[model samples]
Target: MKKILAALLIVVSQNVLAQTTQKPVLHGKNWVAITGKPLAATAGAMTFQKGGNAVDAACAMLAATCTMWDVLSWGGETQALIYHPGQKKVFGINALGVAPSGATVDYFKDNDMEYPPAFGPLAATTPGTFGGIITMLAEYGTLSLKDVLEPAMQMAQGYPIEAQTANQIESNKDKVKEWPYSKAVFLPHMGEEREAPHAGEIFVQEDLYNTLKKLVDTEQKALSEGKSRKEALQLAYDRFYTGDIAEEIVRSVKEQGGLFEMEDLANWQVKIEDPLHVNYKGIDVFKLREWTQGPALLQSLNILENFDLKKMGYNSANYINTIYQTMSLAFADRDFYYGDPDFGQASPMEGLLSKQYAKERAKLIQERNVEDIGPGDPYPFQGGTNPFKDLLEKRKDALSYFEPENPISGLEDPFLEEFLLGTTTVQAADAEGWVVSITPSGGWVPAVIAGETGIGLSQRMQSFVLNEKLNPFNVLEPGKRPRVTLTPSMALKDGRPFLSFAVQGGDTQDQNLLQFFLNVVEFDMTVQEAAEAANINSYQMQSSFGAHESKPGAISLSTQTPPWVRNELKKRGYKMDFQERTSGPINAIWFDWKHGTFWGGSSNHGEDYGIAW
Candidate 1:
C-alpha cells in the first residue's frame, strides 16, 4: 500500500508541475504576432503565409476579431500605430467615431438625463472601424480588403463559440434580449427556452456575414470599373460611410429614437496623423496624441526617467511606490488636459512632454500616496490655459466623486457599467521590418445592433462629457472626436522598430503598457517574463468614464505580488485592494535588430494567443 501511494504521489506532483510551467515565448525568423483571440492570430499568420505584410496581417487579425470576439463589433472604433521601415516613420490612425450632428447638450437635457444611457441607440456614435481598416490597407497593406476580410466573413457565418465568448454572451443576455436584432445574433433561441450559446456550440450570424459580403461586393464592383486598388478601396469605404449602409444606419438610429443623421455619416473620415513620442534612455516610445490617453505613458516615462528604477529593484516596494505616484501625477494632468485637440482648443502637448515640465512634475511624487492633485500649469511651456481649473473649482463640493466609487470595481463606476466595458488589441511584425499595433474596440454587448445592417453602433459617445460648458471634451459639435481611451503603442530602438504592443483595459491601458515597457527595458526581462509579472494600478486620478470618479490613495496589487509589498503599501497609507489581476491582458511582439529575430508574448490571464513562424 505504501509503494502504491508513493507512486500515485509522484504522478500527481508531475501533473501539477506540468500545469504550472510557463509557456515559452514564441520565436520566429520571418514573423511573429499576438492577438486577443486564437482564431484572430491564426488569421494573421495565414495572411503572412499569403505574402501579406505586417499591416495586412494586423488588419486581417482585427477583422477576424470583430467576427470571433463578442467584445468587439463590425461597426466599432479602432486605432492603429504603424511603423514603416522604409520611411522610418510611425503613423497614427485615429479611427474613433465622433458625436452626431444632433447630439447636443440640449438633447440630453430635453430627455431629462445628465448623461447618455450605458447601452442603447442614444449611446451610439458614427462607426469608424471599417474606414480605419480600409485606410490602412490603402496606404500600407499589400492585400486587398476582400482578401483580408474573407476569414472574418466565414467566421461570422458560423463558428463554434468558445468558453470566453459564451461567458460574455451570457453575461449580456439580459440586454441582448431587449433588442430584436441583438437577440437574433446573440440569443437566437430566446423564445425556445434555451440559454445563451454554450461553449463549443455553433453560433451563426447570417446578418453579419451578409453585411461583410456587401462591402466585398462593393469593392469588387469598383475594381471591375477599372479603378486602382486604392481607389477601389475608397469606393468600398464610401459605401459604408456615405452609401446604402450609411442610410440604413441612420434610418435605424432614427427609428430607434436616437440622435443620428445622414450628415454625420457623410462627414466622417479617419484622421491619419503623426504619432507623438518621447525618448527614454536611447529608445523612442510612440503613441497617439491628446485624443487618447497615450500621451500619459510618455509623461510617466519622462518623470520616471529621473529615477533609478533598476537600482530600486523590480517589483520592490520603493519601485512600486515611485511608479504609482508618478502615474498618479501624469493621469491627473491627462484628465484635465488631454482631449480632442482640434475641438478642445490648444492642448499642452509640447509642455506636458517637455523634459523640464516632467522634472517639475516629478517633484510631486512623495514618500506617501496623494490623490486628486489636479491639472498643472503647462501653458507656460506648451501654450494653453488650464481648462479644468474652473471646472475643478466648480465641482469642489463634489471632489469625492472623482475617486472610483467601489474599491473592487476595477476602475468602473457601478452606475455606468456597460459604457465602460470595452476594448481588445492585436499586433504583428513581418520580415521586412514593418510593424503594426492596433486596438479595435467599442460596439460590443452594451451597443445596440443597427436594424438589418448587422453592424452594432459604438457607445463611444458616452466618453464625451454631457456638460459642454466647462468640459473641453464635451463640445457637442458634429465632427468633434470624443476623447478616447483606445491607445496602441510602438517603440523604436536605434532608429528601427523595436516593439509593438497594446491592451484592452480602458483607463488602465497606458498604465499596463508603461509597466510592461519598464519591465523589459529597465529590468532586462524578456517580453514574456515582463508580461507575466504582477502589476500595480493606482486609482488616485479621475476616471475616463462618464462618472469620472477617483479613489484617493487607492491602489490595487495583483495577487501574485509578495505579501510583504502589500503590507509596505498599506503602511504608506495607501487604501489597498487585492485583485487576481490589475490590468488588461497584453499582446506584444519584440524585434531583435542584431539577431534578426522576432519574439512574441501574450497574457495567460485571458484567451490571448501568440505565434511565430
Candidate 2:
C-alpha cells in the first residue's frame, strides 16, 4: 500500500507540472511584443521592424493601446518597469497623475461622499500617459517620437472598432451621455437604437488624430530649429503640459466643473524612480515603489519563501489555503501601510519587506483560514516604535464592518465587479537586451472625453481615501499621488533580465503575479503555460476601485479546480465561488539566456495577443 501511494503521488506531481497551453509560446530571436489588443501588439512589432529598440517599441505599443482605448487613453496614468541592457539595471517610470489642486479629503467629505465618485470629470487626475511615453522615448529610446507615434496616429485617423469596446460603449451609453464631449464621440448615431459604433465599423477620431499630430509636429519644428534630439523631445513635452494643449485641457476641465488647472498640468512631471526589489531565492524581483500596491508582492514572496511550494502540489487544498492566508496577511499590510511614500507620512517599507517580518507573519498562519487577518506591525523590525498602533487597533475593530456582502455564487456580484476592474498590459523585448513591462490603465469605455483633445480623462482620483484612518499616507491632497493598483513586474537572475510581466486586474494584480511567478520558477512551466494557468483570487484586501470595500472570507476558484480541493477549502472556512477563467489577461516575456532568445506569453482570457520574430 505504501509503494502504491508513492507511485500515485509521483503521477499526480507529473500531471500537475505538465500543462498544455491553449496558445503556443511565442518565440523571438530579435524581438517580441504582447498587449491587450492585436493591433497594439502589431504596432510594437512595426516599431521593432523600423529599427527601434524595445523601449521605442514599448512606447509605440502604449500609444496604440491608448488610441484603441484598451481600457486606457492619453489622459490616463502609466506605470512601467524597464530592464536597461546598457546599465544592467531596472528603471521605474512613475507617470501616475496626482490629485488636482481642489482635490482634498475635506472637500470630498463635505460633499457627503464616502470616497470620490468612480467616474466623471470630477474624478480626473492630471494626465500622465503622454508624459510617460515621451520621457521614455527621450531618455532610453533611439527612435524619434514621430517614429513611435506613427502607428497610433494612423489608427486614430480610423480603425475598425472591436466588439468588446463597441458593446461596452453601448451598454454604458446612459453614463456616456452625462459628458457632452463623450456623447459626441461615442454615439455616432445619436438617434439610432444602437448609438455606439458597430464592431468593424470605421471609427474615426479626428480630434485625437490632430492632437497626436501636434506633438509630432512640435518635435519636427524643434529639430528644424537646430535643437538636439533630447531637447526636441523636451520641447514637445512642454507643448503638452505648459503650451496650447495645457490651455485647452484646463479650459474644458473648468467648463465641465472638473478640478484641473494650468498649474496642475504644468507642475505634473514624470518621475524616473528606482524600483523596489526583493531577492526570491536566486532571482531578484523588481516592482514600482510603495506608491503603488507593488510592495505587497514582495512581502508575500518573503513569507512564501519559507515553504516548498512544489511539494504542496499545484492548486492543491493545502497550497490554496497557504496562498490565500499568506496573501491575506500581506494585503492586510498593503491596505493600511502602502501609500505614496513621498507624501504626508513615510511608509515603513524597509520592515514590510524584511525577512524577519515575513517569518513573523508567516508564523501566524493556522491550519484553518484566518478570518480576521489584519496588518502586522513592521516598525520594530526596522528599529522604530509603531506610530500607527492606535490606528491599527481601531482598524482591527472595524474589520467586521467591512466584511464582504453575503456570499454570491456567480461572477456578477457587485463586489467581484469592483474587485476585477480592468486595465491593459504591454510587454516588449529585443535582442539587444532591452525589456519593458507596463500596466497602463484608467479611462475605459464610458469614459468622459476631455473636450476636443479626444482624450478620456482618468478616474484614478477615486483611488484616494478621504480619511486618515483609512490610510494616512494616501489621503487625498493637492498634488499628491493616489496609491494606485497598477504595477509592472520584472525579475533578474544573476545580473541579467529573467522575466518581464504584468496583468490587467485591479487589487488582484499582485495575487495573480505571485502565482504566475511561482508557476514559471518553481513548477518549471513555460511562460505560455504560466500565463494560462488557473489563479485563485482573494477578495480579502480593500479594493482600489469603487467603494473601497473588502470581502474577508470570499475566494474565487477556477472551474477546472477539482471537487475534492473545493471541498477541502470549504472545510477550512472559505466562502467559495467559481469562475470559468480566473487568470486576468497576464502578458509575460521570459529571456531564454541559454537559447539567446525570448519566449512571450499572452493569456487566453481576452483579446490579448502577441507577435515575435
Candidate 3:
C-alpha cells in the first residue's frame, strides 16, 4: 500500500510541474511593449508597426485594455510616467479624480454610513481615463486620437472575454446583478441567471463602442475645419469631460443617489508635473509625487540604500527581512504623510528621501522582527512641524474600533481584498528613446455602469477617509483628488532612459517593483528572471483601504521560496504566511542602452503579453 501511494504521488508531482508555463524574454531593437492582456499588446504592437512612437502605442494599449479588461473601463483613473528624451526629463500625469462638492464626511454621516460603499454611484469619482490618454496624445504622441482609438473601438464592438475577466465577472455577479446597466453589459446573455460568459465567448459593449466612436467623430469634425491635431484632440477631450458624455454620466450618478455633478466633470483635467525620483545604487528610479503611493517606493528605496544589498545576497533571510522591515517603515510614513500634495500644507519628500532620515529609520529594524511603526518626524528635516503626529495618536485610540479580532487567513486578508479592486498596466518604448509606463485602474467588478454610455464610474471615492479630524486624506472641499495607490515606475541609468514598468497590485505595486528592480541591478538577473523569482510582501503597516487595518509583523512569502529561508525568517520572530507565488502580474521593458536593444517580460499569472518588433 505504501509503495502504491508513493508511485501516485510521483505522478501527481510530475503533472503539476508539466502544467507550469515558462515565459520567454522578448527582445527587439526598434520597439518593445507589454500589457496585462494579450489583445491590448496586439493593439500596441499594431500601432508601433504603423510607425507610431511609444506614446502613441501606449495610448492605444490603454484604450484596448479599457475595452477587454473589465477591471479597467473608460470611466477610470490613470497615472502615467513618461520619459521624453528630447527634453531630457520625465513627466508625471496625475489623472486621478477628486471628491465631489457634496462628498463631505457630514454627507455620509447623514446617510448613516461610516465608509463609502465599495460598489455604487455614491463611490464613483469623475472618470479620468479619457482625459489622461487624450492629454498624453496631445502633448507627446505623434498619432491622431482616431488612429490610436480605432483598435479599441473595434474591440468594444465585440471581443472574446478571457478566462481572468470571466472569472472576475462571475465572482462579483451577485453584486453586479443588482445594477441593471452593469448586468446588461457584463451578464448580457445570462437572462436573469447572472452567469458570466464562458472563456472565449464573444462579449460586446455596443454603448462603449458608440461612446468611443463619438469621441473620434468629434475630433474629425474639428479637423474638417482645418484645426491642428492638438485643437482636434482638445475637442475630443471636451466631448468626454464637458460635453454630452459628461452630462449623461452626471445624470446617471445623481439619479442613483450619488453626488457627482456637471461642475466636477467640466473642471476635470489631468495635472502634468515633474516626477519624483531617488538615486538607488547607480540608477535613478522615478515615480509620481504624494497624491499616489509612488513616493512610498522612493522612501523604501532610500531606506534600503542604507544597506549593502549585494552583500546580504538576493532572497536571503537577512535580505528579505531587511527589505520587509524597511518597507513597513516606509508604508507607515505613507499612511501619515502621503496625501494630495496640493492640498496639504507641508510635503515630506525632502525628509522621506533624505539619507539621514533613512539611517534614523533603519535603526528601528533590529535583530528580532519589529511590527507596526508609526510615521516618523520627517518635518524636522524639512523645517516644518510634523502634521501627522497628532493624527497618528488619535488613530491609535481609534484602532480599537477598527482592528479585526480574529486573525485573518492570507487569502481573505485586507491585502488581497484591496488588490482585487484591480488595475491594468502598459509599457512601451520606441527606438527613438521615448518610453511610457501607465497604470489604468478603477471601474472594477460590481461597478456602476453609467446609463447608455458604456462607461462605468470609478469607485475611487472608497479611498477617501470619512474621519476629517484624524485622516489627512479626509473628505473636505470638492476637487481635492484622493490619495491613490496607482503608482507607475521608470528608471534612468547614467542620465539616459533605462527602463519602464508598472504593476497593478494596489499597495503591493511598489513592493513588487522594488524587488524586481533589485533583481536586475543588484543581483545581475535578467528582467524575466527577476520578475519570476520568489518575493516577499509585508502587511505590517496600515492597508490603503477598508478600515486601514494593520497586522503588525505580518509578512507573506512565496511558497516557492526555499524551506531554509522560511524557517530562518520564522526563527527571527516574524509572522509569516506562504502564498503559491508573488502577487503581481507585473509588466516591464528594459532599455539596454549599451546595446541599443529593448528587452521585455510580462507575467503569465493572468493573460499578460509581451511583444517586440
Best by lDDT: 2
All candidates' TM-scores? 0.93, 0.96, 0.94
> What does candidate 2's lDDT look like per residue over 1-613, in tens digits?
9999999999988876664778888999999999999999999999999999999999999999999989899999999998888899999999999999898878888889888999898799999999999999988999999999999999999999999999989999999998899999889989999999999999899899989999999999999999999999998899999999889888998888898989999999899999999999999999999989988999999999998899999999999999999999999899889888778679999999999999999999887998888889999999999888888877754432355455654777776787888889999999998999999997888788988989999999999887667777788889989999999999999899898999998999999999999999989989999999999999888888888887778899999999999888888988888888887789999999998999999989879999999
Q: In model 1, how large is the Cα lDDT of residue 34? A: 79
Number of clashing residue pairs in every model?
A: 7, 0, 0
Writing each residue's lDDT as its tens digit, candidate 3 over 1-613 gives 9999999999999977764336878889999878888898999999998889999999999999888754778888999999997998999998888788688878877888766666788787889998999999999999888899989998888888888888889888888877878888888668645488888899889999999999999999999999999999999999888899888888878877788889999987789999899998888999998888888888888888788999999889999889988888888777767778777574678988888888899989876677646778887876777766767677665441232433347777655576434588989999888999998898877788998899988878777776743456544457877778898999998889877878877778888888988888889877777767777877666666665566776677888788998789888877777888774777888877778899897886767898998
User: 1 or 2, which is superior by TM-score?
Assistant: 2
Per-candidate RMSD, Å: 3.3, 5.7, 4.8
Candidate 2 has a TM-score of 0.96
lDDT by residue for model 1 (1-613), tens: 9999999999998877764315568889898767888888888988888899989988988898888754778778889999888998999998988888777778887988766665788888789888899999999999888899988988888888898878777877888777777777778666655567888898888878888899999889988889899998998888888888888888988887777888888888899999899999999999998888899999999999999999999878899999998888888778766788877466778999999899999898888776556666776776556655666566444443534344555435362242235477888998897899998887876458888888887877767666643355545556777777789999998889878888887777888899999989998878887777777877676666666566677777887778888888878777766677654587888888779899887886678887799
Weakest 10 consecutive residues of candidate 1 by summed lDDT: 411-420
The CA lDDT of each predicted structure is 0.80, 0.91, 0.82
Which residues of candidate 2, in runs, are more than 4 Å off? 1-19, 397-406
Error of 1 at 587 (Å): 0.7
Q: Where is model 1 more than 4 Å wrong at Cα?
A: 1-21, 383-389, 395-406, 409-422, 468-470
How do all the candidates rank in terms of lDDT, highest first?
A: 2, 3, 1
